[model samples]
Target chain A: MQDLGIRVLFMGNNFIRLLGGLWITVKISLISVGLSIVFGLLLGMIMTLKNPIVKCLTKIYLEFIRIMPQLVLLFLVYFGATKSFGLQLSGEVSAVIVFTMWGTAEMGDLVRGALISIPKHQYESGAALGLESRQIYRYIIVPQTLRRLLPLAINLATRMVKTTSLIVLIGVVEVLKVAQQIIEANRYTVPDSALWIYGCVFFLYFIVCWPVSRLAVRMEKKWEN
Target chain B: MEGQEKLLEIHHLHKDYGNGAVLKDVSLDIHKGEVLVLIGPSGCGKSTFLRCMNGLEQIQSGEIRLDGEVITDPKTKWSEVRQKIGMVFQSYELFPHMTVINNILLGPLKVQKKEKKEAEKEAEQLLERVGLLDKKDAYPRQLSGGQKQRVAIVRALIMKPEILLFDEVTAALDPEMVREVLDVMLELAKEGSTMVIVTHEMQFARAVADRIVFLDGGEVVEMAAPEQFFTQPETERAKRFLDTLSFE
Candidate 1:
């Protein structure tokens, strides 16, 4: 009888360890996405300001983020910052920081696009109705911007979740890292186990990300009119 | 119009967009309970002139007074002044997310800080006046163009403004829908609402206006009663403008 490699997952606590690793990935992504939304909204509004200095600064920031890759940003923060600044940041904290920086920039640009797409007459109507600038945003601009922004922002969240896979490179023992450890330990005993181990990792990622992608698509279709 | 007090005064108003003049040394006075119509060629600044009165556009050099208070001063709080002046745009510009009643009540409840119950009651009355009482809970997108414009008017009117400015309000409506919106304006005129109107609807202008101000090249060329202005314009430019309109 041929031995099936699927038994490798239940041999010890390998599956549980993979789940724990996934929790770390999710925790890092959750904190980073939450922070990005708050900061991104503020950054988005600032990007739309008419002031020359503010507009220039935000333009530079957006361009810099666009020009640099997220993987490089993670490396710079995790490896370079620790050496240059003599700081001790855990791999998880560093992952969160880099993802937040990337997420905020992407989310901020989405917000700016949404804000400017509203017709100029909307603001004029608010002013004509005697609304103060703050009240104009609260009553007219913010609500409309949110409607246009939520679906795009939700898509960014799913992308961030998938991108968290890169954190394993920075020494975070997340899912992929756990999968590698299990495969390495079983190389002699279960020589054919590599395929099953990787397949499980793929399934883990699918389970977490599929529903979120579906939600974003549903929201986009609902508001398409 | 002779004995009525001046509700709005414009003195030597100069406006430019940092280039050539859009409104050049223009001045006019609007009396209480009078309907003043401004007719002009496109880009002659009739809309810009109306926007200036509401402080929506900054003037290079000028003074505007409402009830004898200088409103064009940079130190002036335009929000407070705008509450006294209501404007309806060429496009209806109603908030799409809000229902008819909420749109009308926004200025009253948020800007005026009125009690919600009181504001809602006034909103209903204004909506009823515009024959949109049944659309109080309807969103802007669900209504016809004329219906939306009327709701825009109701939105402006709920502020209880001292004067109303209409900048080509019916220009975007269908030929059939135009009359319904104009009829509402005609009723407001009969009710003695102080109004400044810019329109291409010459017949409605003649019927609703106490006086007609003809403008060309950003300057007022002739100001006279509508009956005389329509029949016999004083300036060559004014006569030429009417000639072009008749061709249309």
Candidate 2:
């Protein structure tokens, strides 16, 4: 077995290919996170509705998403549904759909918690201020809820970034898949190249997620203060 | 006296929670430019009665008329009544995310749909009146209890309501802070804003209230002018309640 040299670390073509793959991962995460926030906010509001029927329906959706593993969800969207219903979905699209569903459930719960956490007197005060129900929500309730929700939502976005690695299982050529391909191709020439290549993938994910985690911490502290 | 305009009239106002009645057959009239302070022990319907005025707590039966219009009547628009009668809560529920200026401006801008510059000017004036103009840019969390409550009062006043309801405004403040809020309220009262205050501050009740109402077990036990109510309370319940409170 030939000794694997550190020179393989920054191979020009391999670096470009890895970056291209990382870009795809980031694109998928961004799209999914955006869709998740919108869907989550709507669902969360529904979950907190005064009507029992709407509340129950939202609760059911939340439970369904929480109970099912995201990997299974991705497979169902990418492979199972395509075969069973004659529906065709691209791997990247399926990845986005699955992650959005997961992120939305988590986000919806966060929103519900934030909304409910506001003191009951806030509503009474709003009503007392001669505000109509819509006006109260627009001026009083929604602003406070959004403030409480920001930190949690940021943390969820970082989690989504890390979880994007699972999409490679569905044949999406994200960073991990690219690293695997590079290591496999160079295995005969350099036996231990996979270790260094995988390490790079790990560092890449850490580099992307650490800033977001730091941002979340900073926001949490700022809000607390 | 008969030709004078009546600001508020409640006729046989009844409110119940489940099997228990909180306010039963409560009827009273408040004249224009009057400050009515409702004082009672816990579980008395003073707060509930104040809530009923603005349709915050719906009455099971009976009628509340504001400015010759029956608010409790099915045909009456609640939004209109609420817009005219602003209520301040004990907790001073200032929107924590909003600055003091925004909190004051929100009601006028959103509910009244006033122009931005107009609302800002009104808010600034109201904040100045409350002695909080310097803290206009500060969030509710950054303000003290007294400051927050003052901001809430200013927020309510920016709508320029015909009547302001105070649901124990000073009950939530520190001992020292209570005077500042009470001072603001006194100024509002002096400006001839018709007010219905539910409070335990007997000193304030005697100082600012034109009439004092004593409520017990959800019923109006006695309603008299502040001088008569404080000096010669007719009911044994009122005297007993006064004995229980350290009003000095």
Candidate 3:
């Protein structure tokens, strides 16, 4: 009430910059999530194969991704690859690649869990009913797995959105980076703006993520019956 | 039944779980319009034998011919063959996400590519036969175990398979509920449906079986008419098996 210093956000295009920054974050997350779902589904199914070699290879992939830190992955894709392999990847492109790789692995594991959670008798019943293997997945397995996977996947989606803040480290100019820039620019004119600017960023993240969490909860409750 | 056409033929079937054998050199034949019941000690591979008939369990070495086509061959289209050999499980494995009618219509409409209207009509008739026409819209989870088992039966019957395999279908049902499911199978037997049933219900087995195949230790100990097999068993193993049943 005394000197809130929130007026700096209203000064000349600062809020628009924040929206643009959030758009960048949302775009990256959407693209990564879309690709992760398609590729993750395939990886999940492959992981469930009975072949020993396939199982071993997918195990290696899943473990490698899980063991590596995402920040390190972003650096390797952004800085390491350009210097060592001479690939010209932009910061945004590098962020998407790293996030997608991480998302796909996590999502693939989720899919594998869902697929295996189905009872063995379900597949046997489908087969005994003369459904082809693909038809079994299409008509029987996938429908059931989707029902089990959706709420978990929505939680994954929201996590991805929040994690997109990490992209600011790679200089992708997302919401967190824009907030920092605005706070630094107003540091002298509005000495107390850091708290307000950071608070606004937290609000922005909440507005984006809270509804998705609620949606997941609603779907889980509805499906429970 | 011996002179009738053979709907299914098996020769020297062998199955193992990589550690040891489950079915060993088992051979049997199912004739058209015959109800054959397989009864044995638990884990004697009676259920494994029924599953093999439908290719649910792959025999390590055997020949299973369905109407003279060698369905045991690796290249055989088991899915196409399975269309003619329906199976009901110990657990009613109804598609839980689907209503009763959809579960019944799935095979006919998807695998056979039948007209939806015709399939739906047949599904209703089958459900009606099982006294489940009223439950056509209910999910599997909403039904009692016996009701779910009847729906499973209807789901199998709509395929109109040449032979149906029942893997202890009523083993999981309550005592009072078992009668309702058994009555349906008894009616099918009366109407001369070819069936292979594995069950521990000796009374129902005696009533419904045209022939009873007694298995012990993964081998066919005896095969005789239910009257002969139940009354005066030929083998010591069969006698001991029947004696244990009487003890219960």
Best by DockQ: 1
What TM-score, computed on C-alpha atoms, does each candidate reach?
0.91, 0.88, 0.90
Question: What's the distance in Å from true for residue B57, model 1?
Answer: 1.2
lDDT winner? 1
Candidate 1 per-residue C-alpha lDDT over B5-101 given as tens digits, one digit per residue, 9 for 90 to 100: 9999999999999889999999999999999999999999999999999989999998999999999987988889999999999997998878888
User: Candidate 1 has which clashing residue pairs, if any?
Assistant: none
Tell me, by TM-score, which candidate is best. Answer: 1
Rank candidates by lDDT, best first: 1, 3, 2
Q: Give the local distance difference test score of model 1.
A: 0.92
Each candidate's lDDT (Cα)? 0.92, 0.87, 0.91
Candidate 1 docking band: medium
Give the DockQ-based CAPRI class for model 2: medium
**Better-scoring candidate (lDDT), 1 or 2:** 1
Please list the residue runs of candidate 3 whose C-alpha ends up more than 4 Å from where it truly belongs after superposition.
A1-4, A50-57, A79-89, A222-225, B16-21, B60-62, B68-70, B174-176
Model 2 residue A19 lDDT score? 82
lDDT of 3 at B152: 91
Task: Report the C-alpha lDDT of model 3 over A150-215, residue by residue, as the tens digit.
Answer: 999889999999888888788899999999999989888898998888888899889989999999
Q: Model 3 has how many clashing residue pairs?
A: 0
C-alpha lDDT (0 to 100) for residue A21 of candidate 2: 90
* Least well predicted 10-residue stretch by lDDT in candidate 1 chain B: B239-248
- TM-score of the first chain in candidate 1 relative to the native first chain: 0.93
